[model samples]
Target: MAYSSGGRLPFESASKLGHLNVIESEWVQSLLKDFETNDVDNADNYENDIWESFDPSSVQSLNHIWAADGSYVSVEENHKELAFVKTALMTVEQGKIAAIDKEYPHPLKLQEIMKDSALFHATVFPLRNLKSDKGNIYDTVRHVIYDSMRTDENGQYFETLKWLAYKKWDGQKNNSLSFECPHCSKVIETGIPYDQDTGICPHCHKEVLLTDMIGFHLDMNEENASDSVASHYMLIMEMLMLFTVIRLQWANKDTTLISDTLFIKDGPMTLNGQYSKLVPNIREFLNFAKNKERPIHIIGSEKSGSFFEYLSLSSRFVKPDPGIIKYAVLNHDYIRRVIQRAPDRGNPYGLRTNWGEKVFVYLDENTHMVLNMTTGGYDRSDAYPKSSDIIGLQRILATLPALVSRKYEGALYPIELVNGIASMSNYPSAKILQDFVRDAVH
Candidate 1:
């Protein structure tokens, strides 16, 4: 029988088959074993000694809010070799979609079917190389993405990642975010680490492959390439979306119409892979936005995770203040107790990619409560730093609860709007992109 662990069950249970239930239990056990082997018990480390608590009394009024999200799918044809990847980027402002970007990268085999359609003009992606390699599509897609990152909406190229990396590396006292050698697993730094494009790891004295350090594995076969491509597209969308926000704020600083606007993203503020090394640059970008006429309240809210699961359990015990919103930073002890399992006896919280402090916001009694938050703050070197702006974080906490869905426990209204517009399906987004190209060309 499905019973409520916390006053009421968080979700309704679906009818379960006995065999499926057995399979699920076995899969969970396997996952627990894998977690123990990885030593995830000691994975979370908080830099601060004391987690600051805040009392949120009131929320600031905001005029505009912007949220962005992306979705993608891979469609393999009858032959299984030829595939098409359809990706969509949607941005919403004030509960309406402000922009949309859609792209379909298909194999040359699709050209015959899509005769002269405008959709296939530059959409015919090459899968083979001059030597007729089978998986050259990866390089072609990478090149297109790289070019897009450098180019603006007007098709003009500018220095972005490389320049930002060089600037940040030049200013940093030590390269804390340096790539580890694949051969030695030791961090290495070059004389001009950012300018070289690529380098050899000093520890191993071997060439460093960007693909290894970056989470996205570029050298994988076509079947696995879809994941890498999707991740790349999402990351690019995030970067561009942020760039647009900053640009708009910069241009409209003098006018009150754009000032005091809040930008919300669907996930954590931290970027992963080689892109993660640019955290310092992102901090600088935030600083640039803040220096304008009115402060830009940019923050991210996560809807799901093990962290949120634990937060839900921990919430049942706390009695919150109604007049004042309460919050605390997540320390090592709290995180370990809540998230760690058996066999993890060590005390290293191994969260390095995230630079912000993880905080818990207790918003009122039971309309819905507890936001797992990370705040952007002043930290030049360490990827995850202890020092965060409590006031700024409090501002975010205050503003967010007002935006939460009244009927849903963990969803924000802005994110829900963008998800409805950007989410993909096999029937609509993926199938439509594929069918249209084939139908138009034929």
Candidate 2:
């Protein structure tokens, strides 16, 4: 018996071929346009001038701060109303004023009415000045309110607002120290110094490293130790700048309120490897602060490497200057060996080696021979290389004094020899060296 075969098409196959649950591209595009237009209109309607809209008398002096995960929300239905109130508070604190129509020209004017209305309750709270104000009732309440209002999509922004609040109230204590164990829920009470290696959590008995909490670990002897130290030192400088701006703003309450500060990183800003995610937010926050003119400064540190090479190659954007120079001082014998092995070409003080690469060598009384690898094998008797061609080396020499004054324990050689070798590979005459020393010493 031959029966007519009738089978339903599989949902996956139908969906894949755009036969089931398919969205038209034009429809999707129209929907996106609607969102885009709405966003633009909202942004245009947003009040840029918050100060004019805020009432000084209505200002709620937030004294106690709690850093809560900005992703939790209460399940209770009544708490939903409280969540709305909390959201309104957060929006105001975060510089997001409500869009007003003809009925409400100023949002603060509406806020005042809202504060007086039965629906809204106004409370005057005392501020806590101590860092040890954790586990307080007010903190717990604040956390509950924050968690109720926070959502997963806005979690990062919520955390950022929490960080900013912590800075305003506690002076950035949350970032500087850890009060709770990240791995364990145990509270750490020990007032450990920031540079300390570990803080013992009394409850957990675990050695909680401070660096682990602050997202940086210190190892002075690690390979590539200088890079780590340099990066951390640069961050410290930026943090100092941030603190300076905050202090300035706090001192002058009546002046124009500044929100964003700027930091100019010296090289291409990278947050790769262990610090990949943190660098972007740090840069963004810095840029935001800078745009607001919030007493911020930008700094960039440069050394000889790919970073400097890239900068030199793109010198059109940068002013014409000698590139940076980096040298490692070797023992006197080592220097002599290098110079002796360097095969001479017909050019004076210049050599062309077996590999057909030319090098210029100059021996200084400082027991160091300066080699010019960038200038090629050119004799000093020939046309001297442009001073601007070696700006990198010049910058290194210029910064040496400040480095030395900082008590940096590193190898050093005569700056004059380094400079002369950098500019002209033919070592300066003994008479010239003596005269240079006389001028430098005086």
Candidate 3:
């Protein structure tokens, strides 16, 4: 009865409400009274030295503000599921808009400037519903992913997106991607096949696809594997697309554009799980670019999380003069002891995956930023990341004023724009997608 044209039944309604009666009973409540969890409230304890203040230095405009975001929706029907993943890389020239528009610009002037602003692309891969798809689920997934990366948006994004992974944005070429073989556990390095191409594992002779390098296939199984693979696919797509944008900014040999542009990824600059293998490649590319004297500026802004919540709470203390900037580098010890309440022993935070350290910036009492930022590639050291390594924190912070958006609290314009491009409404979007897949199969 709860179904709304999405399918046979809403999954939530499948669970009967009869269990609530037992949970509401006094005897059941008494049995559950001893459980406890971490305190969600913030502590007032002092860490006075970590906080730093600076005079907001005036900086030149960023020539292009580029942001990347992605979304994926899974459609399931009659014991089968498929995922539709969509990602967008949107770019707008903040400097040009201000130079051309008047003090109170007309609506059409703004519209005309933004008419050609975004590059959007979408692709599909097999999930639970792979039986009817062209080939083996894993092989089909690899083919689709490879083609997705090769997307060409007219002439604007002519290069294959996979070129970011398969080759390099600024270095020597490697046509093959490598990973530990799932069957034999030996490292298998080879090129992805064209059409139904498959790599033969040298150690065990197990056939592998190029997409296996990322490890989404590890989470996949014959039973109800749609969501896990879909989520992983969405995240990897977002990271790859962001780097693809960075590659585009490189423009083959015109590297100065990299310095003049600002890249904003929707979430933290970290890739987790088996997907984390991409982190080293990212750090390597950033370092390679830096060694060549081309450092790109990128920031990841968080809107809803423990970190963002802490920023909202801590911003109460940051009331500075008109020109002063207040910020705190959330070092590992502070994060371990305070934010996460984890035992100080063990590995450094994000030792395997994070390319940037967390830094909380306060623009004003009303504008607080919880940022994951880094430059000169990802930190590779075992020791705590130093403040100096965050190469352009001050410069990037100075440019924030021109990019802030009033639509959301502490939101930046480019991220807000990409969110709009990537966000999909569930009611209409899911239902429509489900209908389309259903029609296509018939």
Candidate 4:
């Protein structure tokens, strides 16, 4: 007897139809309702007054240049959580990997590093113990979740919170950092209450975590598990890299080496997550570098953004001759047009997320070369602010053409080098982690 297929033919098969409509045309039309487009010709409106013209020769020769990037991966997925999370930090100098830090199986390994390293200090507790209602020792866990959001791989490590608690951590001694109430934003004059997850905010009259008050936000969306972890890993690693650079800067204080070097990162100089409050600290670092006399230029250059995308499509921009570069000193008025926003808060008057002043640069008319640049030390406010020193902006603009990547269009070589070195390929990371664990067991 021939066995007949028991359920619904095992599976239903359908012929592949090319270019099938994934979204309803009506929905597409609805999305287009708020879609606004302006004539590309308008880009020329401020080209003359805003564009800073520079020749290729004006680019400065630097003694040293460095860039950094970080990567994270979930090694194994369990029923309700990732079985293992792996993270790696890479720093490159002059197209060479100068430093690297990685964590596997446990993030606490990172905390140990931070605790022992003279370059860093732990301002906040990596883990805390909570007492039950009866005032009995309840349980303890890692500080992996913040403001009800699950953090990514090895999130339990507390070194990530040091930036937020730096203002309170005493050097050489791991002391509790003073924090404001999350609800009130009021400074808790008496230090964080003992054995309590939350404290009463005097100003707002609400219960809030003292740690959350430090660069933590309830408005941040952390619903996507993978995305959330990746964000934390990136932020923590970026800050750590900055710390490394800062230590270098401090070590060479008596020498001119640090001053001659330029520190560049792949993305904006800004940090996100619970560590965002550290931005002011980064700004201070910039100022400190500048005050040392011969300042080393540090900047964050983006390869893509909505503004960059629009600038690419705009044909009205005046192109520079071969080996020359053209740059625009972006203002609020011009930015609003390029980045469309709701009538309420979309105006380009102030910085929403980015800490650097938005700059648009064309590497050359000879190629499809465009770059987005941001420098540190500028005050982040909502109002349209001009670079106090236009000459400084011009000097930075002049440095780009020399750093352009010969391999990729619209890419910077240093950033490309660092990114390539830092990025962890899926296969390599998996193999490395697996082999590492296997060796450990053996």
Which clashing pairs does model 3 show? none
**Candidate 2 per-residue C-alpha lDDT over 53-109 given as tens digits, one digit per residue, 9 for 90 to 100:** 111233222221111001112223432211111110110111111222322346575
Whole-structure CA lDDT of model 1: 0.45
User: On residues 1-442, what C-alpha lDDT tens digit does candidate 1 reach at each position?
Assistant: 2232333212213224333545356665454334334232222432222334455555554545666555554444553333233323232333222221112323352332222211100112223222234335544444445444444333211233443444432345332245545455565554225444346677666765433334333333433344454555565455445444444444442455444566666666656555565565556545543554344566566666766666564554456666665566655555555555434455244344554445665665553333333333453332333426422564576566556654456566656545544553431321222322233211
Q: Judging by TM-score against the true structure, name the best candidate.
A: 3
Error of 3 at 409 (Å): 2.0
Segments in model 3 whose C-alpha atoms lie over 4 Å from true places:
1-43, 46-49, 96-110, 151-177, 182-186, 189-198, 377-383, 424-442
Candidate 1, pairs of clashing residues: 42-348, 43-349, 43-350, 44-349, 45-349, 56-325, 114-441, 115-441
Candidate 2 residue spans exceeding 4 A from truth? 1-211, 215-234, 241-243, 254-272, 275-281, 287-307, 314-442
lDDT of 4 by residue, 1-442 (tens): 2223333221121113213463235654343332322333455533344565567484554545655555544433233223122323322233222221221213454333223111111111111132334322111111233422223223222333443334221133322345555444567565445434455665676765534544333332222233344455454555455444444344443456555565666665555544555555544444554565545555666666766565665524565567666666666665665454435464344343444556667765533343333344554344344554222455555555456666654566556644544543441221211222233211
TM-score of 4: 0.57
In order of lDDT, best first, we have: 3, 1, 4, 2
Candidate 3 at 274: error in angstroms?
Answer: 0.3
Model 1 residue runs over 4 Å out of place are 1-59, 79-135, 147-152, 155-226, 251-259, 273-275, 287-296, 340-351, 365-391, 424-442
Candidate 2 matches the true fold with a TM-score of 0.24
